[model samples]
Target chain A: MRPFSFTKIDNAANALAAKKEKSQFIAGGTNLVDLMKKNIAQPEQVLDVTTALSSEIEDFTKGIRIGAMARNSALTTNAIVLEKYPLVSKAVLAGASPQIRNMASTAGNLLQRTRCPYFYDVTTACNKRKPNSGCSALEGENRMSAVIGYSEQCVAVHPSDLCVALAALDAKVNIENSKNKKSVISFGDFHRLPGNEPNRDNNLPENALITSVEIPSNGFQKHSAYLKIRDRDSYAFALVSVAAALELQGTRIVAARLASGGVAHKPWRWYDAEAFLKGKEATAANFSEAANIAVQDLKPLAHNGFKKEMLQGAIATALQQCLTV
Target chain B: MSKESTYSRRAFLKASGAFVMLASIPYSLKAMYVDVDKLTVVPKQALSITVSINKKSYSVPADTRTTLLDLLREELHLTGAKKGCDHGQCGACTVHVDGERVLSCLTLSAMIQGKEVTTIEGLADGEKLHPMQQAFIECDGFQCGYCTPGQIMSAVACVKEGHTGSVAEIKEFMSGNLCRCGAYNGIVQSIQKVANA
Candidate 1:
């Protein structure tokens, strides 16, 4: 890895000052260090913000507010988060192991790069890394690539479980700039599709830093959970995962929110499924209908024909659990 | 001597003995307490700080680039905290800073000034083994043991953090500390023994 000067800041203001000079902010450093070793990311200076940012958990009458700097392990283990937001806790727990989670932050999890093989291997042409260079994953080994919201330019799935849960929860990100100005954006808008510029994944400016993630209190979260299917039980990325929250009035669905991972450029929120499940009788048949709507438009690659069925199964299983609970 | 003086001396000796016994309790139930605010690393700018580790105080000069793992292994000859996948992917370099488990590899030594740092070497009495350490031995929680120090440190924190409720929870919480040998069954069992005890 290329050596860089490390500066420890005491507050957000100092961090912004360093960002103004184009220094890279290091949070968990789980992803940053790996990319640096690959020469994919080489910053002249690294701003270490682990100590400066406080890891506090605040409780409101309605919901909990998690500081962006709070470690993933802390967020998952917090009593309130575990009781009220099991989906969020499950998502956090299902991710990388305790050591990485101890260092990885809640905000940093959403900012992790895609696990597309081409994106990591510098020899391959990845549009996400070098814009318009051509995507090698398009015609290469793409068993783990996307089957939804994928353009011909890129097929990388967003490799994060927390983002999928956040998408379904309608969480918001609070971002601060060098001038100390703060702005908020819903989690859905935080990550973007490849579109024409696959390089830009988030809406934040180069100098903006994530401050916290705000999850509003929603009534339907009582039966929510994050279920991931991976090749192995521990320490492996998802083959397909589902985040589902449903509210029911006896047999009929009152409200629902759904999102999927390991299958899209962003956390693929199933708006069509949401609309279909609304006011419909909540049953296995209805869940199948909603699942069909969720993956009807998927365009699978040669080696991943099973992803379409896998995504449908994930949606079905997630909905079944929500309904049963 | 007065009867009261003899009685007080006997009581004092008994209390001291109990205190020693309390400190020597099975490592699993032992509380590894550390203070975070008072921690600071050695200085590069001519500001010297002394750090106490395993009952010994070391006054050393260090650069900003130095990490706690590096300072212990390279400068102090405490090579127990192995540097595996230095970017924090592997927990080979986990240590207790202020009683909280942290990746020493990712933590800069300068950040730990005046703080008590505990490694695997600090987890035991002179001859008696820590319960978790002994459990690892009996259960064979490791093979090659390159990641043993880190695994033990995380296991200590895992019990402290109250994540020993069930096997699934233990597996999830301990997932951060990877044992490449796939000795997860034994590792989990060792932690369960410590937690159950």
Candidate 2:
């Protein structure tokens, strides 16, 4: 890590005002510090914004507004989250370990960089790490890389389990901008698809700080499941994860929200599949067909061709799990 | 935990928060800090901070890049927290910051000002061992013992966090600390013993 000046952020407005060129905000430091250790991120100035942000999880009649600085641990155990948004709660618990979940903030989790081994190794040529240097994962170890929404520049997938659930639930991100004005961006628009600019992860505005995430009321509360398929049962990144939420009447599906992680650059949602499942019988055959539609356009790499089948089975199983609940 | 019960000159000097006082301190006092200067002139970044470790206050001049794990093991001479992996992938450097278990390897030393840090060395009451520590010995919860400190610290917090309702629950909650020697059976037994008691 290079020598850098540190500034203690006093508030959201001052934190934005204090931003200079090559200045990165440090909240949990779970990912940023690791990047710094590997020299992947060398910010000239480090801003500590943990105290400047609120950590409240406000639950209202409309829905839940989770403060950006709220720790992942709090989301797992909070009564409101567990009762009303179990899909989100389960996704948070399924991601990192208890210690990491305790320290990592919600906003930091949303802004997590890909866990591509090539990106971590500074010696390797990674386009995401260095612009136009090269994409190591394109021909390297890409079993965990994206199968869709990837370009020649980068194939790394977004690595947030909470994001998968939030994407499915139609969440909105409230941004505290540099002008001290508030703007809300939809979850889908918040993250980029790694097209021409793989180096840029999200669509965050200039000097923008995420204040909270607003999740509106949805009727999938009773039937929602977050299924993560990983090598280990716990404390491991997902091979493929499915967040299935269904608004069902008896054995008939009224509405559905299906999205997946580890399959694309962003949380890959199957709006077509969701539309196909509407008003249909909530059976294995329908769910299987929906899963097939979800994977129709997936372009898997050599090492991860089996991920298509794995994801197909996972999506079907996750939808079935939601029904059983 | 008390911010008032500190008389250590190192702690007091940092608490004073004046560069002139640091310059006036004796030669012996000058030797106690890590780097007591500026960042622009020198090629190093250092900050004077006051932190509490094992219920003792410390006023030290720390490098801005020093992690809490390095600060504990190198500067403060608290070797209970081991660094199996400096990255957050492994939990060998687990410690309680403000009573919540967090990975010390990722926590910056400058971020810990005015916060209570409890390492494995602070778990016992004087000569008497903590209940979890005593249980680990009875159940033979470790072989190499490299990850024992982290495991015990996480286990203690697991029980306090009400995550010990079952053996499966205990295993899930203690999944952060990895014992490469496959001592999970005994580690789980030790947690069970302490939780049940």
Q: Give lDDT tens digits, candidate 2, residues A22-134.
A: 89999999999999988888887899999999899999889999998999999999998888899999899888899999999999998989998999998999888989998
Docking class of 1: incorrect
Q: Estimated TM-score per prediction?
A: 0.84, 0.91
How would you encode candidate 2's per-residue C-alpha lDDT over B94-193 as one tens digit per residue? 9999999999999999998999999999999989999999999999999999999999999999989989888889988998999999999999999999
Stretches of model 2 off by over 4 angstroms after superposition: B1-42
lDDT of 1 by residue, A212-294 (tens): 88888776756776789888787778888999998777878888999988988889899999999999987899889899998
Highest TM-score, which number? 2
Docking quality (DockQ) of candidate 2: 0.38
Residues B1-197, model 1: lDDT tens digits: 87688679779999999999988887655433333321332232322446877768888876545667888999899988889977676788988877878888766565566778888999998889999999999999999899999999999999998999999989877776878898889999999999999
TM-score of chain A of 1: 0.96
Query: Worst 10-residue stretch by lDDT in candidate 1 chain A?
Result: A1-10
**Clash pairs for candidate 1:** A97-B176, A98-B176, A99-B176, B39-B113, B39-B115, B40-B112, B40-B113, B40-B114, B41-B112, B41-B113
Cα lDDT, all candidates: 0.82, 0.91
